[model samples]
Target: MSEAPSASPHTPLPAAVPPLTAPSVPPHASSALLASLAPLLHEWLPRQRWFAGKGRPVDRFTLVSATELMPLTGSPGLLHLLVRAHQPQTAPPSGSRGAPPPADCYQLLLGVRRSLPTSLASSLIGQVQDGPLSGHSVYEAMEDPRLATLLLERLRVPGPLGSLRFEKEPKADVQTGLAPRVLGLEQSNSSLVYGDTFILKIFRRLHPGANPDLELPLALAQEGCARVPEPVAWFEGANPDDPYEPYTLGLLQPFLREAQDGWQLALRHLADGRDFTDEAHALGRATAEVHTALAAALPTLSLGRPQTELLADQMTDRLDTAVQAVPALLPYAPGLRRAFDALRRLSSAGPAVSAQRVHGDLHLGQALRNGDGEWSVIDFEGEPAKSITERRRPQPVVRDVAGMLRSFDYAARTNQPWNPEWAQRCRAAYCEGYAAVSGTDPRTMPELLRAYETDKAVYEVLYEARHRPDWLAVPMAAVQRLATT
Candidate 1:
C-alpha cells in the first residue's frame, strides 16, 4: 500500500437542489389536457423508486416525443415520453458563466389513452379503478399495468425491439427460461426475474454505449473469474443514428437463486456466534484472485511512486468534504490528518504494485454465498449515478478491499440487535484470508486498512447524507472509530 496525500481545506455548501415541484409538459393537444396530465406524471414519478430526479425541482419540462404501444380498450396502449427537466446551474464565483443548467432527462414509459369528458377531469391521472375514466364512460386508462405488460412482451420477443435489433444466432432461440417477474427493489431501473433463471434489468434512464454490467463481467468471466453472474445476453439496438432514442434497454444474466446475500449471511454468522474468520479469509482470497485476474485481463495504468501517497491524497479529499458537511467531524480532524501522514510515510517503505482494473463498488451486497459454498458476485453496474468514464478508471485493488471491509461493518451495525461483535470477527477473518493469498505483510495491513476504511467511511457519510440520512450512524460511527484508533 502507498502513502496517502494531505488533507484539504473544508468548505460549507448549500443543499444540491431545492425541494421538488410538479413538472409542466405542455400538452400537444390542449392546455386543458396539459393541466390534467402534468400533475399526474409529477405524482407518479416521485412514487417510483426508478425515477432519478425524485425530490428534485423540475425547472422546466419538454416532451421530445411520444409513442403508443397498444390499443386503449381490450388491449392496453403503452405511452412512452421523451421528457427533460432543467435544474439550476451551479457556477463558480468567477466572471465566466458555468456549464449549462443540469438537465434531468429520461424516457417515461406509461399506459395512457383519451378519457371521456366528465363533470370534471379526475384529480388522479393514472389511478386504477374498477370501471372506465368515468362511471358512465366507456374509455379507461392507466400507466403501470399497461406499460409493464408491454415491456414484458417486448422482452419476450425473440430479438430486440424497434431499430434495436440483435444478430441472429443459432443459440438465440435456446431457452433461457426467462419468465419476467418484476422486482420491487429499484429507483431508476425496472428489474424483472425471467423464469427464476435470469434477471432483465431495464434501465429507465437512457445513455449511449454498452451497459457496464454486460461489458465488464463478460470480460472478467472470459478472464476465468467465476465470481460474477454469467452474462447470458444483452438487449440493445444495432442502429447508432438515433439520439433521444432508447437502446440497450436491458440485460439478461443467470440469477443466483440458492445463495444468501453476503450481507445477510455475515449478519447471521455474527448473530449465531459462528466464527467468520474462515469465511472472511475465503472472501479475502477470492478478492485477491479477482484483482489478479482483472489485472491480467485489463490494461495496466501507471501512477507515480509511493502508492501510499496517492491513498493519503484520496483520503484527505474525502475527509475534507465530510468535515464540512457534518461539523461533528471537526474534532477528529487532527487524527485523520495524522493517519494520512503515516500512510504517506509507509508508501515509500515498499515496492509499488502495478495498478489494475478493479471492481469500483465491492461490498457484501455485491456477493452471494451459494448453496455449494462458493461466493458469486453480481451487479457490475458500478454506481449507477456516476458517468461511464469515472466507472472505467483504473484504481488500486485495496480500494475494493476497503469497500468489503466497510460492508462488513455495515452488516454488523445493521444487525446489532442480533450481535454486536459481528463486524470485528468478520474483519479479522477477511484480512487474514486476504493476507494469506496476496502475501501482504501483517504489519503493513493496519495503515492500508485504516486508509481504505477511512476512505470508505467518508464516502458512506456523504452517501448516507444524500440518500438515507437515517442510516448515517453506520458511517459516522466508523469515522469516529477510525479517528480514535
Candidate 2:
C-alpha cells in the first residue's frame, strides 16, 4: 500500500479556461441510451467495491452528467458518467414518502459491447433491456483493456471531451500504448497501472476543489523532493456556472515498479523477529525531509492559546462521537480527555506550537521502500471521512509523528507473539532520526503527542467496531494503555 499526498504557497492556481459551451448532450450521447442504462446501474453499483452505499437498496437513479466520448455504431461504446443513486428511505415517515431520500454521486466508466467477451464476462454490469443499447452488455471500463487503452491515449494527447479537460505536465514525457492493469487492493479509490511506466488513480468520490493528492505531490516535486512520485498528467472538470471550483477526476504519475509496501515489509521483519530500527530510522528521516520541504513550500500557521483550545474541543468532540458509536469507548472517554486537558494547559502556559501542512493520515501502509533502501511517502488525502477543507487545514507536525508511532504499536500487537519492546525501540529510533534532521525532537512535547495518539486510537476504535469487529481488540488494548499509562 502506498499513499499520494499535494501544493506550495507560491504555486499558481490552475488557470480557468472559458467553459466549453455546446449542446447539452455530447454528440455521441443520447437521452434514450441513458434511460436504458439507469436501471442496470442501480443493480450493478451496489455490488462494486468502490460504491459507498452498500447493504442499502437503491430507490432510484438521477443523471447528473453523461458524456459519450466514443460511440458504438459497429464497435464498443465508451461512456463517462456522474450519476446520483438515492437510497431507500428506512426512517422517513409515511407523509414524507414524496420527498426524495438521501443520494450520493458516483463516477462510472462504462464499456458497452453487443456480445460478451469471455475475458470481460466477470466485469459485466448487465444487459441493456431497451433503447439504443438494448442488446448490449455493459461492463466497468477499467476491466476492458481496450477502454483502458483509450484512457491512456487521451492522457498521452491532452484534449477536451465535452466538459472534461485533460492536461499533461509541461516537462512530463508520457509514453502510451502500454498494457493497463487494475490494482486489486481495497482502497477508497480505484487505480490502474499502465505497464511499469505510469499509474492512474480514478477518484470515485467527487469533491469541488483542487484535490490535495494531486496538488501536494506536484508541489513537492516542484520543491525538488525526490521522496514523492512525479505527477505527469491529470483531468479536471469545470462547470460554466462556477469556473473557480474545478473537480479533479484522475491523476497520472510515474510508477515505482520495484517499491515494496512498508506495511508488508514491517510484517516480514516482525515474522523474522529482526530489528527494524534501521528501516524505521530511514523512514523518519524521509518524513522529516518532506515536512521541511512542505513548510517552506506552503503557508505555516501558529497556534496560540485560543486555537489550541479549539483543537482540544475537536478532540473531545471526536471522543464523544466515538463513544456513541462504539459504546466500548465510553469508559475511556474521561481518561482520554485528560490528555487533551494537559495539552490545553501546556499550550496556555508554554510557547505557541507551530502548525504546517502535514500527512494527516500517516501510517506504515502509506509509505514505500525501494530495493535501494530509500523510503517514499504517498497519499496526502488525509482522513477519507473529512471534507476537502478539513483535510487541507494545517496542523502540528507531531500529529503525523504520532500516527507513525501508533502504527509501530499496531505491527507489534497484531502480529503473533506481541513484543512491546520492538515497537518501543523503533519509536525511539524514528524520533531520533527525525530530530537529527529537523533539529527538534517530537517527543519534547509529550502532551501534544499523547493527545494526538489518543485521538487516533479513538478513531481506530470506532473504525474497527464498524468494519472489523474481531480486530477491535487491537485499539481497545491501545486505549487502555493510553488511559492507564
Judging by TM-score against the true structure, name the best candidate.
2
- Model 2, range 231-339, lDDT digits (tens) per residue? 8999887643368877788999888889999989999999999999999999999999999999988999899999999999889888987888888887888888899
Off by over 4 Å in 1: 1-38, 63-74, 79-82, 89-102, 113-160, 163-179, 237-248, 305-314, 342-353, 417-421, 435-448, 465-470
lDDT values of the candidates? 0.61, 0.82
lDDT by residue for model 1 (1-485), tens:
22122111111111231111212222453233333445555656556566666666656565544334443332223444555555455444345565653365565555444442332134234543332322122222221332343443444454533344332223433242233446765666767665566666766665555656776777887797887776665655332344544345567667777888887787777777676767777888777777777777879875555455776886797788778877777887787777777778766775554467678889987887877677776776777777655677777677788888888888878865735476777777777777787787333656765776687787788879888989988888888888888
Q: Relative to the unseen true structure, what is the Cα RMSD of model 2? A: 7.8
